[model samples]
Target: MDVRKLAACVLVAATAGCTVVPGSNMNRMNSVWFDDTPEEYTPAETDIQYIPINATVLAHLNQQAQKQPLSNAELEAAISSYHYKIGLGDILTITVWEHPELTIPSGSFRGAEESGNEVKADGSVFYPYAGTLYVLGLTTSEVKDLVTERLSSVIKRPQVDVRVASFKSQRVYVSGAVKQPGIAPVTNVPLTLVDAIDQRGGLDEDAAWGDVRLTRNGHTRNISLRSLYEQGAWSENILLQHGDQIHVPRNDADKIFVLGEVNRPQGLPMSRTGTTLAEALASANGINESKADGRGIYVLRNTGISRDENNNPIYTATIYHLNAASAVGFMLADKFALTPRDIVYVSPAPITRWNRFLSQLLPSIVATDRIGDIQNNN
Candidate 1:
């Protein structure tokens, strides 16, 4: 071959040798470029928890108060006479005009018990002539009319009056995820589920904001408080019923776990301000400079519950490559939206990993003391 051609051939051979091949050392090194691993250590634990980002966003979204628009059914129900049934913890007072003795105590005597009175286990007071009358559910007018009808037969021209002495029978329960959860009185004051929560001291910090559960009669309905308050979906502020229970579960599903090479490897709570991969890294004390390859950042997402054609359950996993140098990368980190129990990993450079492995094998031989000093100083 000519001298010039020979020289070109040698140069080409050197370039070819250096070219990266899949599964080769050069390829592995490149792979480690953006790996989310620490330089001097392997992941101490792989079972990092996942949290949903949506829940955090929703929580902040519910801070504002919005009036719930009434639906056709709700409107109709509101217009109609709602006869509330009496339950435990109710007291009733009855009076009969003209007939002093029949009027019970002969005058407007306000005492615990007087003439011709009956108290119910569910907190309702009944009258002898009124039969098994449940004054607990009846309004003042309804109770009066009922008593008048019964007295007509017993006494000559009997005029009867009925009133509630104490309101303890009608109550609704608020529990879970709320600041103060307990039974609240449902008095003449009209109250909705939101009002009940407010009366109970609002939702707790860890309460999930997406949907609060209304469990009644063994059936559950999800009400989105955030949407009701922020998105103008007022339908969520449902009117509460006696004995109805509202449960707010903790926001355990709205946090992300960051591990491997991070200074503070732990689970971080997500919020409405939103979180970015970079921000999360910073929150966890950033990646170990010596161990982290800025290029090898990965996000593992769990796509929940799928079914195969055979009706078998299948779980799918997704791996995302994040670029730290680009603005888009930061945006992705912020927008990626983590769910409860999500795992974020950063792989180290090949040289770093090798050094780490060697250090583990022979602590005395490796410069771990210097590495620790550098880490401490940094």
Candidate 2:
């Protein structure tokens, strides 16, 4: 035989070995393959290329929850924790002792004609007798001290009281899964995570009951709401700080999987509304029409167990089988909800076994290419 023909035979043999033939008798088997229904599915040895549906759903849910904004309750709680300080946009009400003429009716020492008392861009407030006094970064007490010293020179024993009328200077941001989201006014009142949520009008219907997150100074901390309310774990209720952001993200982590002989074998989103086997199969693009043995559908799940220090067996695997052709199959599907990474395999028909056997034998026959070619050429 020519070298070209030998090379062709080698190539065909190699390629055929890589091809897989579906089993034909997978549907005809009447006996159940599994003892009990598994809680989770394990991937087959041949499914190295497939993605783990549980991990995919987890990643997807995490992404969805991160995009939500903060609620109003969170904003108010944040504001309450802030210490009273003087900053831009703060309205100060200054009162002068025994000086009705100097004290304007509008509460500003600058007089009613000059408008409200405002902290200037340079951090100074213009008063009638005290001119421009820098008050930025100073607490309410500090501002009063500075003003009294300035007034000592102009008025005879000038008594002054400084109070913040509008708290627009300091604020905290609260967002995600809440009714109202925005910057909350900061005050001397202590604000906790629960108070923040209350200020935001409470968590939405889809809010995650697990962990609520607070971001501040480029650091993030996860606080469990369920632990705080249900478990009575008040340690999870952290005090909010100024410029802190409270976020109540939604729960999107619930999911189920349908794999193996299904056409679109993958993870399907779970609904609180409930789901059935037929529905899950439909979501996974339905069973493989040509390859699936409709008679012997099996759901394989791993029993949760871990090896101890002595290497003793800690877990046992459970399996469940349902005849797709049986009347009770649909009911079983609804009763058995698929968990993460569960494997659903549909066996092939009996003829598929013959085809696979023939495929294996075909490689040997092709090896006799030299004799066949010589016979044909002769």
Candidate 3:
């Protein structure tokens, strides 16, 4: 149990290719920061790559980001039409010219909605001359034509105009990261994606643009609302249907984790626009200058893994090393984009590792030396 003997044994075990204490593995991670072996850079040969952050890689990544995700198409296709039609429980007002007795007029106190004919659960609305007629799937214009034809038999050249007095049948629900999260009615004039969002008071300040979710019929799809406005990708503004749900998700998922030797290591959420590597480091109060390795700042992405067919976990992280020691390195960091779930790791300097090791090991060595001196005195 002597401290010197334990240290000697650990040194021996590590050299003998045996498993030592967990702390001994610190050097293994140290290998990732500074090791410049050429074979690892080869895509076909190695599992992990060591890509230096530079102009070329930044441009490529930025271009790839501009290409919207393929899932947007499926979301757009789900909403085939934006046309509005009559549905059960909807109030319809039919106005007749020069027919005061026949048409139930709204009084000074009563509104047109109060005198309107409501589509019953059976999808039928009853009128004076039209009798009981099914109006489901019929638009306001079509309903007017049908009512005028029925009234023509009673009154010659019956002038009739039909409109939706109240919309109470179909609805599009909006929630999450919006100024007003509530239901937006599907009106006689077709409601598109933008209309529903505007009706709910637009997106909230904390909302992420690309994270707009549209859920319908138990299927959920994502569309980038930012593209609609900024990039002029008008295709994103697809039609919304009855029973459709729109949610502008919060930017929680777009946060990046700053770990290791940063002054204030924490998860930083991205803005509605975006967050670059420079911004992320700035938010973390930059790296610890005294202890951090200037050449070892890394951005590790896709650190997540999927299991192979054999049930073995597979890691395919694309790591980008940034040597802040270089003059242009900080400029490159400004250009590098930080995506959601990325890890910005600033590895410790060699002196830092030595200092930490001595901090842990010196106390035991000192106590043992004191005990030895006490025994000699005894």
Q: Each model's TM-score? A: 0.58, 0.47, 0.79
RMSD of 1: 11.2
Top candidate by lDDT: 3
> lDDT tens string, model 3, 214-287?
99999999988876776666667777789999988888788899988889999988766678888999999999
Query: Candidate 1: lDDT of 157?
Result: 75
lDDT of each: 0.63, 0.64, 0.79
Give lDDT tens digits, candidate 2, residues 50-76: 222233443563455343433345545
Number of clashes recorded per candidate:
32, 23, 0
The digit string of per-residue lDDT tens for model 1 on 168-243 reads 7678888898878898888666677778999999988788766689987788998877656556565677677777
Sort the predicted structures by lDDT, highest score first: 3, 2, 1
- Which parts of model 3 have CA positions greater than 4 angstroms off? 1-27, 30-50, 69-81, 105-109, 226-230, 252-254, 303-307, 311-316, 367-378
lDDT of 3 at 209: 74
State which candidate has the highest TM-score: 3
Which candidate do you rate higher for TM-score, 1 or 3? 3
Candidate 3 total steric clashes: 0
Question: Model 2 clash tally?
Answer: 23
